[model samples]
Target chain A: MASHFDVAAYALGTLDARGTEAFEGHLASCANCQVELFELQELPGLLDTVAETWPDAPVRGAVIYGLPTKRRRFQHLGAATAAAVLVFLSGAVTAIGFLGWDGADPPAASEPPTALTRLDPVAEEPGGVRGSLESSTSHAWVETTPEGSRIALDLGGITGSTPCSAVVVSRAGETTEIALFDPPKKGERVVVSGTTPYPVAQIDRVEVRRVSSGKIITTLKAPEK
Target chain B: MTERAEWTESRQSAMLPRVGRHTRAVRPVAVVPDDPKDEWVRQLYRQFANQLSAHVLGLTKYDRQWTEDVVQETFIRAWKHADKLDQRPEMLRGWLFVVARRIVIDTHRGRQVRPIEIRGTDIAEDRVGVSDKADSTVDAIVVHDALRRISADQREAIIETYLKGHTVDEAAVLLGIPPGTVKSRTYHAMRALRRALRARG
Candidate 1:
């Protein structure tokens, strides 16, 4: 039989599982072992009662399983690597996001208030007056005037081997053929600027086409004012 | 071997008598108060939950909600296995430590297999509330006073190492001392604090 201290240690969980089981077997008939186990178990309760001020904050799932499932067996390695990458990426993204346009410092609050006018051309172009004929892979600008409006199409970002063209139509059935640039590249802007022969309020639609494949990628329209 | 097996069967049958005419005529066994058992379970809960929570929080970088969940699960498991808990209150503490450790391992493993959403905002608020409540507790104030009554070096070591959660090396560096010295001082300070708190009680 082991000494009282050994049994106590086993009961306390300081011993490995085999040692604990052996000790427990001995403890079944030994009154001394039972007494010691009782004593050691109280230590946790005392510490908890004293440390009552800290509320339990449960760990979140994202923090636990951020790594891919395949690497779970090597959790130590996986967690360490994932944590390092997450921390690095978070810091980098935060730093970049904070550096607003023209290198302005980020706002004091962590989250910035939503911008009122989100008129960045790349974002608004897809839902612009032009429908599917609008170039998905291109940048566009729409400038409205009291009399008419002009749109500059830049289809540099589109991926295709074919060439494209554009056609503009007014609400009054007046049609105009705006020549499309072939395979638009960076630094090339297709300007379709002209006074609408119809009144500004009557002009309705604009369309861009892929001439080689005969596909309409962009379309724009003016809602009845 | 057959005799041993028959003995085991008979023991089981004796412990669990048949529920029939003869059993109904026999008196039930006496019910005894298990004060030690109840106290031991209570003590285990009291001793381990907060420290486990603190350790988990520190390990996980103050993930407030996860710490709470782990603590809650640890205690619930302890309660469920109350029969297995040691009778000595001191041993109960260590038993709970082991349980808490297992709970942590299980939690970590489960997290690997599942998707977890971290609610950053609520955790921050919960931590603030916990700290505020701890500060308001009378025992905390008493402990703080006892801590102040100790030697300045001992008090400083305790404050920086345990209360402030600084690593021994970090506290040593801050105090311009060696890590070993810092550790020894903190240990002695803890002993002193324990004595003081016990005396007050």
Candidate 2:
């Protein structure tokens, strides 16, 4: 005989298979247990609420299987030829502006993408070199528009989740603040898009600096026009 | 190559049952991280990550990496919009769930990675209940407070069995008690919790 206490166990999904079978048999005749089950139906969802705040590791990497692997395309090319091909590809990528964008004219700032230039860590600062800076990575690029330039930045490895601004500097030493954003976590990548009124060719460099301390974190130098 | 393509298509069709069929192109947005909010990401992780992961795990059909990716992206978006968020636990939970749902749908449509087709009535389900989701946090807080008011033994019984998803027998072993005692404690605990929640209401 399944006791009345079986209601809670059944409701909570904690019953063993035999226990569950017995309980269901008992529940068939027990109108009280039937009513109680309906009343306690919200228990599991409520329980999930409490479980949400439990401090456990959330992200786990998946083991993938059975997916088709890519076939190597350039296996026949020698190392020197491969190197030359890579150089040509990069140069072609730059000339084409952004991969997958083809048109008779360069795209408007409101349209698609452009080549992203690497933003190297600023090697020197006033007080000393940023010793812990080598671990971070960043990239920036700009597109020219009738109004000015549209700057897009990809950033990673920023510590302290600090508020920072992307500043566009001109060859004439004038500076324009293009974007203001904050890094969400240490060593996680973030993308920011902002606009500046300066033309792309006239731009000299872009700098990402901390808003609070005004410390320069990284810089991207534009190609010479 | 042809066999692989056919296999991928079959797998995609199998996976699409719960995703709901609504095909629309969603452009990926630039995500800016947080600024000046001290330990906000850490706090978000502690309070929401476990639940978010579980919720997303179901949506992704237990694909752990995709679950992690969705959760990570949701948190980053949350951090980016920290200043704009309500910051209340219930509201934040709702926001995170909604954002995570959108990410899953976007991923299903092959926006961020290779496309996989998922079809179902799920999007409507996800959309309709989002705002109502905040009430869940409220209910959780109420139930959690009620759990504290119950006897320690009763609370542990519920935790081991209900919260941890253990069978009564398994929880008995973990709690170092007989299964009968575990059931008895859970019975009493549920009664006490119902009373406590009623009192609160």
Candidate 3:
């Protein structure tokens, strides 16, 4: 019992003979060490199998040993590294672009849209309301800008890359095709926007539907005036 | 032991058998470098090359070309970070494993995003999906990721005692520290690993 810190050492089976003897003497009466030892019992086995979880464990007798030491290998490797870096950069850029879209920033690539929140006071009209069709989730808001009414939509749970259109319908049964875009991959947020000449007061609903089938995927309603 | 002697010993031990099998494929030319950084990187590479290759080969579905690329990339990164990296053998191994593992993961994700026809038409249907198929696979990634989250010393401790299967006294010699220090580092590393696994889950 000179050292009670041999719990991990003993569990790891790394304790020297004398140290093991002392720890076992202490362990006979030590309930705390017993519990600690039991908890760690699985650790070594798990560690041994950690490398086995990958795709080709035991390697299948592949002759893939040693680093590529040739000068020619390094040449192509240089090109591969550049391409890999480009792919990584593009992925990062796409992520950042999506984050920007999630904000009030519009999705147009040519000219940046004026910030919707900074636009002239959103006319005292119907406020935004949440709506969904089936399992899909969607939200839409109409902001009155000097140019026209800007509708922002956040649609999620869309499956596949379907070409879709956002149509704004007024209470008077008139419809305006405001935006056309592809829905994002499944389980990802799709933030999009479209501008309409109609004001916020006149618009009654916004529906996102497949461009080909014209079937509604989701709709966001404007609160009644 | 001198770094050069250690490098030679480690390299020969790991490369001897493989070299005999594939004599033409590998030249096994040992280059003695003048620069300290080059020497350090060579040492790290020699010591951990086999371990990284095996782990990364498994990761890349034993794609020899891809495994070599990842291993190369990992060492390049280690070379770039050599100034900041702890020169200890165990710490270097941990750093290499984490970096190499991430390269494998990133390459997989990149391929998934834009399927590259590297392995011909039959792209191994199962690998095309998410990396979370099996609980053990997820655990492997989680554990490797957690290795980087802990301090270098603690990471080295776990590598010595658990991963490398070294006894406490043996680990002490390899780490150039006392046995008590090794014990404490292993204990702390275990706790940090537990917390990291929980956080990841």
Candidate 4:
């Protein structure tokens, strides 16, 4: 028999349900196992300390993360990729207008936003759509379905110094406004994933512009399919 | 062979955030890396750093210097891929836990060999460099240092059976000993650790 090492096994999370239940029976009586297991319980916490050091260090997080001190946004990505990303950013941001999260026209959504902690952080980019951006510092990809196209925009460096909004403007001057935010602090990346009701052909440009001054921070023209 | 983790309601609530009363229009979801200058991460570190440090330390088998370096590297990677991490508290904690574990695995894989040396009572403060004021951080360093005091065989037994989350038979197979030996070694290791911890205090 493996003997009364059940406490240790259970502490290590290696016990099956029956074994665990069996150990729980012993654990209820064994003070020695309880105390020893308590010390062993700290094992995982100590392991975490090893990696938690970098954040507590004197150097900046960006420098330690191996990102250059100079803010080279989208420096790792190519120009074509950047434009395509901007196209998606604008498209997705505009989709907020249709989807109903637009900051400007926040449709009757007076209710509190679902707790930020409740959101799934994973970026979901389904395959099968085409899009483009120009003169951009962001990256993007597109997902298309019979319903329409949704653009997944990576807002890595657009933490401008003023309130910002992504506006999708059609050739005929029609516009859908989405994603309004105060200037994000430097080095913060804001990401938006939204779908557009209009096909890629009908959209002329997706511009990330300052809401306060109406100046264009960056703009990407739609690439034709 | 396993610790079953049933998905209770609490653990399963990490679905994406939704808004409004009904589904009138498809919502355009956005995740802005909040507190980009390490504020949010700092808080997260404060919360989970102890548990994560302890687990990673085990993976490295009591290499304090190696553990500290790997933990820092993991968080840096977390920031670089910030958008992927913007989620609920429990999910964020789980995400960091997984990332820290992977870092430990990667760090171990890159090493030529495990040293298994006990530096006596000297905390690897030099390798950790900057002294963290957090009591949990200090305690982790101290406890890890003590693990080194026990014989390597006993320490390895404890790690395989306890920290690595292995069964006794599983640990015995890895350590090339009988299951009985794994237990005795673990029993002695725990006693030694308790003594060392009390002595350090």
lDDT against the true structure, per candidate, is 0.42, 0.54, 0.52, 0.48
Who wins the DockQ comparison? 2
Q: Interface RMSD of the predictions, in order shown?
A: 24.4, 18.9, 18.4, 19.8
Task: Give candidate 4's error at residue B39 in angstroms.
Answer: 50
Task: Candidate 2: list runs displaced more than 4 Å.
Answer: A55-225, B1-134
Model 3 lDDT, full chain set = 0.52
Which segments of candidate 4 are over 4 A away from where they belong?
A1-4, A16-18, A47-225, B1-135, B162-165
In order of the candidates, what TM-score does chain B achieve? 0.39, 0.39, 0.45, 0.37
Predicted structure 2: lDDT? 0.54
Worst 10 residues of 1 chain A by lDDT: A94-103
* Winner of 1 and 3 under TM-score: 3
Off by more than 4 A, model 1: A1-225, B1-136
Worst 10 residues of 4 chain A by lDDT: A57-66
Best model per TM-score: 2
The reply for model 3, stretches above 4 Å from the true place, is A1-4, A51-225, B1-135
Model 1: share of real contacts kept: 0.01
True contacts kept of each: 0.01, 0.29, 0.12, 0.11
lDDT of 1 by residue, A1-225 (tens): 334445423422333444444444455345655554444333222322233322210111111221123124224556655555344323211111111111111222422212211212222221122111122223223333333443333333333457665566776788765454554355433333233344333445656667866666655543222
In angstroms, the error of model 4 at B193 is: 2.1
TM-score of every candidate relative to the true structure = 0.24, 0.31, 0.30, 0.28
Supply the DockQ value of model 1: 0.02
The order of the candidates by lDDT, greatest first, is 2, 3, 4, 1
